[model samples]
Target chain A: MRVEVRLFGGLEKFVKDVRFGEGFPVDLPEGGRVAELLDRLGIPPSQVFSVLINGRHASLADVLREGDRVALFPPLGGG
Target chain B: MGKIVRVDMTARKVTVEEVPEKYRLLGGRALTSQVVHDEVPPTCHPLGPHNKLVIAPGLLSGTPAPSSGRLSVGGKSPLTGGIKEANAGGISSQKLANLGIRAVVVEGRPQDGGWYLLRLSPEGAELLPADDLAGKGTYEVTKICRERFGDKVGVITIGPAGEMMLSAAGVTNNDPEGNSSRYAGRGGLGAVMGSKRLKAIVVDSPSLFNAPLKEPERFKAAAKRFADILHQHPVTGQGLPAYGTNVLMNIINEAGTLPTRNFRFGRFDKAAEVSGEKLAEVAVARGGLATHACHPGCVMRCSNVYPLPDGRVCAPIEYETAWAFGPNLEIGDLDVIGELNYLCNDLGLDTIETGVTLGVLMEAGVIPFGDGEAAIRLLKEVYQGTPMGRIVGSGAAAAGRIFGVTRVPVVKGQGLPAYDPRACKGNGVTYATSPMGADHTAGYAVTANILKVGGYVDPLKPEGQVELSRNLQIATAFIDSTGLCLFVAFAVLDNPEGLPTILEMINAQYGTSLTVEDAMEMGKRVLKAEREFNLWAGFTRADDRLPEFFTYEPLPPHNTVFDVPGEELDRVFDF
Candidate 1:
């Protein structure tokens, strides 16, 4: 399965050679969990506080499908 | 013990009174709202002699608590015509607290059409005629006050917009750098100050963090722990310091909730051009700072200094200002956004209100969208106090009414801020229900709905939105009363020991054993008092609603409308 993964806030530090908002294509086995993608990207599970799948909040345990727009963020907030 | 200074503008007399026992525990928004609810008649005109302006430092303002130097200015809003408590991060609050002043109440409008300046020192406070300083902008007023008094003296002043009694004018104060951009920039409190003929307030105190504490050692330990909590949290410690609040531009755009071009779109094609990352890159390249503190004793330091292309500087252009002038207007230039923000700071207008007004003007074909130079020309008219300027300065609701633009984003005559309610529905609940009139800070559900700070709530859903907004509003009311920056909540919400640590600091300072329950109760009390004041001012549940267009008009990208039921909004205060 192919998914687009983006990082925001300080989470960009985990993935080298990528701009802040640019999405990187990642390939995962069928019925892959969000945690597997984070593991593949070298992101510490504790570091990523927010995960959004297609603009909706998602958890690490959530199953990922092909063509999912997944975004991971460090523990971050502002207004 | 702190004293309350009462200035009778009509009588031209200043008197210091002992803090009444009943009011001794209150500070910040609690103190201001309590005074306004008790003293001012609900039906009185906001600009009339009957409305009193109450300024207060929070309970922990002059202490060693990190980021606790916020000042609250409260009155009946000339903009919203309801109880208002607008606050700012500046040096004045700490100085006022160091001088043992709990609050300053300005009562009775001046009969004579002359302006006065209030000077506060270790000796006492006095009123002096300031007619010479009447027509200046806030930047000049602050500069003059700093030069005439002392460089360290905190200057609180209004600009020509306030002098003209515009509905969107705000009360501004100087930061440590003498930038008069730290403002209680909501609710037209500056117009209320202008109505009293009070032009400027110079606060002179040798002490910075000198609010006396009952148990200094205990307070110190608690404050240290609290600071550590802020430092340890990634949001407060890393993200904010990296790019400041404007960091949200890209994420919000990615989430499809950025409210581009006055809520017509959910995303901007050129969002990255005005994003925080771009801002930091440009600012540092131009010999400016990407991170600075708004006030002393602030550990987060989520502020920036952006040097403009014209050899000018605008400090701390936050996310909302960037959005209001950038994506909301279809302008992709950061310099243009910085210029608009700088103009609002000098003219003493609320940037949110002014930007929304400009968006309405564009909607009505008064100006073209994405035309930065034309927008600049219109804002100059505001500083000049022209008829068109007055219409624009009156706020987005008024501009919409005058121009017959039905898509104006506002609640209770105050403009909606950066977030699009149709997409971020929890914030929509907050906008529809809060007494503060579409204020995002009143109940920032974005923490959960989008940022996933405390917990996650779906931004695109109506389920659990009322509950999310209600809890956040209660928590935010408490945080605002404590004189801490709202940004601290990002850490405190995520940390389990956060609330108790803050309570420990308060108890150590004031010698009171207040628990978390008591703090929550205080939050409820403040909201109930404000709601009661609005009710007395003839606001019904109908007033506690988003604009009708929000429900009917579906925003793009997500194709969502604000479907949170009005009954759910009413139930926000049921607790």
Candidate 2:
């Protein structure tokens, strides 16, 4: 199955499909968890700062359904 | 009479001008902003002689007001090329006010290559050649300047980074203990000071110079009430004084707003290792102070002096610093965080900017995440003037350029502090829309009660957050103009009558009848002025955005992307 993935801040360089695209629009294994998706995307679990699935909170272990959206964010410090 | 001190480097002359009639009503950030806007040409090169560096004490400085010791430094920013003000706690603001010096303007550059240190006192001002102070870090400069001037003097010194002129170099001010650590750290104002060939600014004013209260009894009574309110509040009076703002590390992490490992999640498994409570425990064991004040004449003492194992002191590891260097980099050790704080301070670099930039560098594979030692090693390179160091100190955006990473997290060229937008969308809006170039303190109106504005909306709720951010930003501008430390907002927010009391005190002091609405108007006016300056300085709406990463990537725990639509965001400054 396919699930859309989005990356923010410093992580967007690796997305080859678009120079600046929202939602990575990639193929993901059916019922993949965040951990599996991260491994597939070559993003070390440690490098990813925050994650959101369709505007809500999700754990790394949560299974992603087909057509579900995932977003990746960098750490925040605007002080 | 409050006087404006002017130091012209080219002539090596110092002059004192009486506070101009037009600026008498302004203080702190308001004063600095007005002075810069009135005097400095909008298109002047920030590092050129055309730019002027203005430092002013808030209206309440030296007035025994609660948390009113903020000193605002403003100039054309080398980082963003916009109007910039960086305020911080230190002895300088109060000393300047006590000396009846409303503001100090450093103008022009010296024709000679020699640097100078400008010293001020009740008697007069002096310009001393500081050739020996060149290339010296802030710590040595502070200690050496203090020894030459006397222990009683308050000092402001720049570090090696300022000399090299990394755009984020901050002006280091001595705390009560004379550590050259407390800083007016933002927007590369220090670079401007450095460009003026000023290595240090030493102030040693007698108490005879203190500003006289127009209504002494009213001032005393209002001050008493203000102190009483702060003493009665928990977050400011107790929690902050006891645990310091670092306490927020745990709470924010719990709320899933703490930016961890470059904002990958709302939570960090090792958050306890670098929390305020944890730091408090460590400070107690190491004979370090956890709840010390950052400046003189402050009731809400929220700063600290963290001691490393070598008995060296690393001052006040603020929450944003901890999150930026600790959790965001995956380095949970307080010792490392404290050391980084010291490094940033002595190097005259902005800690939050450097830390966030380092996280971006780590994302670029130049340094591995959670490598505290490697980060430290890289920091040394940055301090020593390597191309890599220059890139890092120039800020995350510059670092992105050198490393070929386009996904830099910056607003108007200034790096964001340590609050993840995915976790706290309210703060995210603030990050996107603040006129001060991604600054958190730009909208620190935690006191919804005093604003007489909207009631409490859960920080997590998206509705009304834009308005909340806007109101808070305006209110913050007003408070900053008062030249008071913003930590007072936490205390004032808890007390239903706290903000009114502040306005009352100002009203009583200024001999005017300014109401809360008028104050709000001033806040809006200041914001508008700053926005106009930024626009004139070439910042567009595209610059008024979060990194695209925030939109496409969802944060962990409370996984939320940047849901605030772009059109809605563009409507932020519509008023």
Candidate 3:
């Protein structure tokens, strides 16, 4: 299955050949969990604080489907 | 340890009195709110002589505690027509605290319409004629004050917009570097000050951090631990210092919550061009700074200095200001945004109110969307007090009324800050129910809703949002009283030891055995006081609502509307 993954707030440093706010395709197994995708992208669970699927908050245990738009971020805050 | 300096503008008399026993323990927002609630009538016209402006430092101000120099300015808000406490970061709070001042209450309007400056030192405070400093920008007023009084003296002043008694005006004070960009820039507190006919305040204190401590060793240890905790937090220690608040530009844009072009969309196509990374890159290239501090003793320096093309600098262009002027107005050019920010800083106007007003004008077709030059030209007219400028400076709500635009984004007559509540529902809940109308900082649920700090509450969901905003509002009210910058919440939310250390420092300083529960009660009491005042001032549950458009209009790209039920919002203050 193909999914789009985006990284923000300098979390792109953890991924190979990725830039902030840019989404790239990632191939994952059918019914893949967010944890597996993080594992595939070499992102430690502790390093990432937020995961969003199609603009809604998602957790690591959430199952991913093909063409899912996933975004990951380090802990970030501002007014 | 505490004295209230009462300055009667009508009588032209300055009197120093011992802080009454009932009000002795309050500080910062708590103190200012108490003063306003006790002395000023709730139904009084906000700019009338009956309205008093109260300025106070927090309980832990003028101490060695890191980032504990925030000042709170409170009064009847000309904009909201209710109780308002606007917070800011600058050197003046600590200076006033060091001088043993609990609060400065400006009472009675001047019968003579002449401007006066209040000069304070260890000896005392006195009102002096400021006619020579009239009609000047805040920067120039601050500069002349600093030059006349020693350079180290803290200068607090308003600008021509305030002088005109515009409801969008804000009170500004100089940072350590003498930039008058540190402002209590909400609720039109500057208009309250302007109505008092007070032009500027020069705080000449030799002692910057002589706040008396009961247990110096214990307080020192606790303060050190708190500073360490702040440093350990990645958001406060690293992400903020690297790019400042504008770092959220890309993150919020990606979350599809960045309100673009007057809330018509959820994302701006030119977001990256005005992002923090771009800001840092350009700022560093132009001999500017990407990170600085708004006040002394701040460890988490998230402020920035962006030098413009005209060789002038706009210190600390915050995220809310950036969003209000950039994406919301469809003006993505950083230089133009900086120029607008600089103009607001000099003119004593609230940037959020001003930007949101400009967005309304664009929505009305008064100016074309994305026209940066037109926006700049319109903003410049504010200084001249032109009729058009007054409309723009009257804030978002008034601008909407005059233009016959129903899409006006405001609550309780105050302009909403950067976050679009429809997409970011937690912040939306906060905007609706907070005692201070439409203020994001009142309960900044963005930490959980979008930034993924504290914890994750789905930004688009209605569930768990009430609880999130409730807890944040309580915690925030308490933090505002401690003279600590609200940004410290990034560390406090993540670290279990954060609150305890802060309490230990406060307890050691004042010799009060206050537990976390007691401190929380202080927060609740502050809210109760504010709510009571607002209720008396005629704010109902209907007034405590987002604009009708937020629920009716669906924002893209998620196509979500603010769905948080009003009954759930009422439960926010159930405690």
Report, in order, each candidate's fnat. Answer: 0.54, 0.05, 0.46
By how many angstroms RMSD does model 3 differ from the true structure?
Answer: 1.9
Candidate 3 chain B: minimum summed lDDT over ten consecutive residues — where?
A: B269-278
Flag the better candidate by DockQ, 2 or 3: 3
Per-residue lDDT of model 1, residues B1-575, tens digit only:
79999999999999999999988888899999999999999999999999999999998999999999999999999999999999899899999999999999999987889999999999899999999898898999998899899999999889888988899999999889999999899989989999999999999999989799999999999999999999999899988888899988977887889988888999898887898888988999999999999889999998899999998889979898999999999999999999999999999898998998999999999999999999999998987789998987889989999989899898998999989998898999998888989899999988888887888888898999999999988988888888899899999999999999999999999999999999999999999999999999999999999989889888888999999888888899998
lDDT (10s digit) by residue, model 3, range B475-513: 999999999999999999989898988899999998988
- Candidate 2: which docking quality band? incorrect
Name model 2 segments beyond 4 Å from true.
A1-79, B445-455
lDDT of 1 at B271: 85
Q: Over the stretch A1-79, how does candidate 3's per-residue lDDT look in tens digits?
A: 9999988766788988887777899999999999999999998898887788887778899999999989887766678
When summed lDDT is taken over every stretch of 10 residues in candidate 1 chain B, the lowest stretch is: B247-256
Candidate that beats the other on DockQ, 1 or 2, i.e. the better one: 1
Candidate 1 structure, TM-score to reference = 0.97
Candidate 3 segments exceeding 4 Å error: A1-5, A13-19, A24-47, A59-66
Q: In DockQ terms, which candidate is top?
A: 1
| Per-candidate alpha-carbon RMSD to the true structure | 1.7, 10.1, 1.9
lDDT of 2 at B169: 92
Q: What's the DockQ of model 2? A: 0.04
Deviation from native of the Cα of residue B546 in model 1, angstroms: 0.5
